[model samples]
Target: MRVYPEQLARQLNPLTPCYLIFGDDPWLVETSKAQICAAAKQQGFEEKVQLTQETGFNWHELQQEWQAMSLFASRRIIELTLPQAKPGTEGSQTLQSLLQQPNPDMLLIIQGPKLASEQTNSKWFKSLDSQGVYVPCITPEGPQFQRWLDARIKHFGLRLQADARAMLFALYEGNLLAADQAMQLLQLLSPEQPIGADELGHYFEDQSRFSVFQLTDALLGNKQDKAQHMLAQLHGEGTAMPILLWSLFKELTLLLQLKSAQAQGTGLNSLWSKHRIWDKRKPLYQAALERLTLPQIEHMLATASKLELMLKQQGVEDWTALSHLCLLFDPKAHKHLAHIELY
Candidate 1:
C-alpha cells in the first residue's frame, strides 16, 4: 500500500479509499497530491470536500463529513490536511475507523508535514499503511540534485551547457519552488539557443548579473586590477556567491592542467592540441603558468574546493571566502598569502 513519486503516474488506484501523502518538501508533496487528485477525478470523482486541522478543529466534523453523502454525486473526493501531522486520540481513531470500513463512494486523501518515526509506527499510520497508499517525498541533494535538474530540463524541452547548468544549480540548490520558477522564466526567454552563463545572466539578471566565463578569464589572466574590478562588479550586480566560486575553481583547474602538461615536458603545440585549447587563448594559459608555480595552483585549487564545501554547509553564510579567492591573484595583496599553502 506504499507508492513512490516516480510510480504515482502509473500505480495510482482510485479504488483505494485512503491516501496518506506527507513530506518536509512542500513542492514535492503538493505535486504528488495534485497527481493523485487528477487520477481520482479521471475515474469519476465529481465532488470535493476539504478539511484542515486547525486550532480548535473538531474531529467530529470529519466523522460527520465521512458519513454524509451528496445527492448530486455518487462519488466524492474528501481531502484532510494536517499542517502539523499530529492527529490526537479522537482524530487518530476516526482515521483508523474510516480505513477499517472501506468506502467505495468516498476517496479519502490525507496530507501533512513529516511525521516522527514513532508517529509513523502509530496505530492510525499502520492502518493507512496496510489499507491505504503512503507516499513520502524526499528532497534531492548533491549529485541527486543534478539528476533532478536534468530530468526537469528534459521535461521542459530545453538544453543547457555545463557552465549554465552549474549556475542554475547554484542559484536554486535547496529550493525546488525557486528552481521551477527559474525554469519557467528560461522557457519563456530562451526557447532556441543552448543556455550558457550569459543566457542565464540575461534572464536571471538579479541572480547572475555578470558572465561566469568572463570572471574565469579575468582570474586566469591575473590582471589584478581588472580582475578585482570585475569581481566587485559581479558582486554588486547581485551575482550568487556559488557561481563566483565555481568560476574561480574552473580557472584554477585549467591552470593546473597547463602546469602539469608543462612539467611533463609536453610541447606547447602538442599540449594545446591535446587539451583542445584554442589558439587565441593559448597566451592566457601560458601567461598564467608563468605567473603561478605548480604549488600555487594546487593551493588555490584547494582553497576553492574548501570554499565550495563551506557554501554547501547548512546555515553558514559568510561570502568573504569568495573575496579571499579574488585577492589571491592580487599582486599587491601579499598580507593574506600566509594562509595560502605553497604546495
Candidate 2:
C-alpha cells in the first residue's frame, strides 16, 4: 500500500500488518516509527518490538527470527533499521530476500532514508508494496507544512496570528523538526498570548545559524558572501552535508517545478494552494524563478550531485569544491568561472 505523508496519521491503524517507513527527513522517519511502535503495542504486540540494525547483522538471522513462531504472543512487530544501506551492500541483498517472503505473524517496519535507485525497483520494494504498506515520510511542503504548524500550535491551545504563522514558516523553511522546536520555545516564552511576527523576530534575534530563511534571502539578493558564510558555518558545525544538500535541492527543485507550472498557465495562487506552498515561500519562489532559468537550476542540481560524490570519495576537503560552486552565484564574479571540472 502506497501512502502520502499527510494521510499517514489517519491511515495508520494498529492492526496493519507491515510498514515501510522511508524518507530523507529524520524527524518524519522517527515520528512514523514511533507511531507504528505505539500502535503495535496498543494491539498487544509490545513484547514483539524487535529492533535490528542492518550493519554487521547476519541477513539469515532476521529471516530466522521472522520465521520463528511467536511464543509470547499471537502477533509480533519487527522493526528493521538500516542506517547505512548503501547501494550494492549485503544489507540491501538481505532486505531484498526478506521483502520477498515476509512472515505473516510479524508486522515488519523497515525504516531508513531515501531508497537507492537500484533498491526502488528491487524485488523487496515490490514485495513490500504488494504485501504491506509503503508510507513515505517525506518532508511536508507548502500548505501541508502550514497546516501541520497550525495543528501543533492548536495542540497546545495556543494561538498565532496569520503573520506569525508566515514568519515561522519563513524561518523554518519547511523544516518540521526546527519549526516544532521553535513553536515549543515560543509557547514557553509567551504562554496564552497570541504570537506576532515581531515576537518571533525578537526571540530569534540572537540565535545563530541564521536559519534557512536567511539562506534564501541571501541567495535571492545575490549576496553570495552571506550564503557562503552560512554554508561554511553549517558545514563546520558538523551538520550532515546530505541533509543540507537535500534542503537546498528541494527548494530549487520546487522552484523549477513551479516555474514550469506557471508557464503552463497555472495561476500562482492555485499552484500555491495545490502544492501547499506557504505564503512566506511565495516571494522566495518568485525570486528564484525569475533569477534562475530551468537550465541553470538543472546545472546546479548536477553540480550538487557531483559535490556529493566528491565528498563521499575525497572526504572533508570537498568543502573547497563547494566554495568554488558558491562563487558561481556571486554577482560580482565572472560567470565563466561557473564551469566545474568533474573528477
Candidate 3:
C-alpha cells in the first residue's frame, strides 16, 4: 500500500480502494490529489466526489457521508484534507474509525502536511498502510534529482546541453516542481533548439531578486550591493524569511558535501551523476566551493538557524538584523563579522 513518489505516475492502478497522499511538498501533494480525482471520475465517481477540509468541521458528518451508501451512483470518492490535526483530538478518533471501514466503491483520499510524530505510526496510519495505498509525494533529494530531471526532459522530447542542465539543477536545488516549470519555460523560449548554459542565464537574468541562482551567484561573486538590494526586495514582497534562509542553508550544505566528495578524488562526471548535479550547475558549485571556507559556511548556517528562531519568536520585526546577516556574505562586508555577532 506504500508507493514511492517516482513510481506514482506509472503505478497508479484504478483498482485501489483508498489513497492517503501526504507529504512536505505542497505542489506534489496537490498534483497527486488532482490526478487521483481525475482517475476517480474516469471510473464514474464524477458526481459523487465529496471534498472536505478538516478544520472546525463536525467529524460526525464525514463518518455519516462515508457510511451512507449511494442511491444512484455506483462509486464515490471522499477527499478529506486536514491542514492541521492536533494529536489525540476528536478528528484523529474519527479518522481512525473511518480507516477501519474500507469500501470497494468509495475511494477515500486523506491528505495533510508531514504527519505528526505520533500519528505517523498510529493505528489509523497503520490501517491505511495495510488497506489503502499511501503515496508519499516527498521532494527528490541530492543526486536522485538529476535522474528525475533526465526522465522529465526525455519525456518532453527535449535535450539540455550538459552545462545548461547543471545550471538548472543548481538554481532549482532539487525542487522538482520549480525545475519542471523552468524546463517548460525553456522549451517555450527555444522550441526547436537544445538549451545551453548561456541561454539559461539569459532566460533567468531578470530574476535577480527571486531566483535562487541569482542569489547564490551574488553571494559567490561577493557582490554585496546586489545581494543587499535583492534581499530588501524579497523582504518587501513579504516572502517568508525562513524560506530564503532554508534555501541558502540547503545550497551551502550541498556545496560543502560536494566539496568534500571532490576532495576525496571523486571524478567530476561521477560526482555530478551521484549528486544529481547537472552540467550547467558545475561552474556555480565549483565557484561556491572555492570561495567559501568551511568555517564561513558553518557560520552562515548557524546564522540562518538563529534568524529562523528569531522570526518565529513573538514581536521580532528585526528585518534590519536579518538584512545585516545576509549582507555579511557580501564581499564588501566580508570582514565585518565583529558587529554582526553583537546583533
Candidate 4:
C-alpha cells in the first residue's frame, strides 16, 4: 500500500481507511495532504477533526472521535499530525487498538516528518502501511529534480528555446514550488511560442514589480480595487497588452474547464490534481468556481479574444478596455457590464 507522490491520485479511488504522509519537503507534504483531503471530501468525509502530537497530547481522542457522530456530516476525517514522526508508548497502543477496530464512518490520515530506516520497519508503521497508504515526500534532487521540472513545464504547455531550459534548471534546481510558479507565469505570458532565457529574466523582473500573477490573484479573490490598481500599474510600467490579455484569457479558459468538469460531475480533488492546483490557493479558485457563471465567463472570454485582435493594430493603446476586462471577473461588476459592450 505504498504510493509515490505523483501516483497518489490514481490510487485515490475507493477511499483507503488510513493514509500516512511523511516528508521533509514542505510543498510536497502540504500538496499531498491537500490531495488526500480533496479526495476524502468527494467520498463524503465532509467534516474534519485535527489532532497534533504535541505537549499534553490526548491519544484517547482518536478513539473518541472514531465513536463520535457528527451533527454536520454523516462521515468525517480525523487528521493526526505528528511533528516528532514517532508515536510514543501510549500513542502506539492507541493506534494499534484503533486499527484493530476499524470504523467505516471515519477516515484516518496521519502526517509527519520523513522516516528513518528503523522507523519504517517498526511494527506500528508496518501495520499502518499494510492497511493503507505510505507516501514519503522526499524532495527531488539532480536528475529527479529535472524530471519534476520538466513535468511541470509540460503541464503548463510551454516550449523553452535556446538556453531557456538550462537557465531555468539552474535557477530553480532544488525548489519545486518556485519552479512551478515560474512555469505558470511563463505559460500565461507566452502560450504560443518558444521562450528564451532573456525573456524569462525580463518577465520575472516585471513579475517582481507586481506580477501578472498578482493581478490574476486579485481577480480570483474578487478584490476589485487591488486588481484595478495592479492592472494600471502593469500598464504604466509597459507590460505588453497581449501578455495581460493572454493571462486573463488563460484564467478564463481554466474557469471554463473547471465549469465544464463540474457539469460532467467530476470530483473537485481530481480536477485540482489534474490541473496542478496547489493546496494554499485552492480556496481562491474554489470560491471562483462556485460563484462565477459559465455564461459570464464565456462572454468575457469572447471580449478578450476580440481585444487581442484589436491590440494587434498599429497605434492602438486601449488601456481603458483592458481595465474594463479586469472588471468582468468581478461578480459584483456584472451589473456594471450588463448594460454595456466592449469591443
TM-score for each of the candidates: 0.60, 0.60, 0.62, 0.58
Highest TM-score among the candidates is held by which one?
3
lDDT of 1: 0.76
For 26-91, candidate 4 gives per-residue lDDT tens digits of 778888889999988888888989999999898888789878889986799999999988898888
The sequence of per-residue lDDT tens digits that candidate 2 reaches over residues 5-66 is: 65676656644556888888767888777777787766667555455574466776777777
In model 3, state the lDDT of residue 12: 53
Residue 252 displacement in candidate 4 (angstroms): 56
Model 2's alpha-carbon lDDT is 0.68
Best model per lDDT:
4
lDDT of 4: 0.82
lDDT against the true structure, per candidate, is 0.76, 0.68, 0.69, 0.82
RMSD values for the candidates in order, in angstroms, are 13.2, 9.5, 9.4, 20.3
Sorted on lDDT, highest at the top, how do the candidates line up?
4, 1, 3, 2
For candidate 2, the TM-score is: 0.60
- Over 1-343, each residue of candidate 1 has an lDDT whose tens digit, in order, gives 6687667776676457788888877778888889988888888888999999999999889887778877886688889998888898888898888866666778888998877788799998998888878888766654776888888888887788999988887666556767877897888887777889877876763332336665666666776655565666677767887777767777788778878888999778777888778886888887877777787778777877777776686544345666666677644454556375422
Residue 342 error for model 3, in Å?
A: 8.6
Off by over 4 Å in 1: 13-15, 205-343
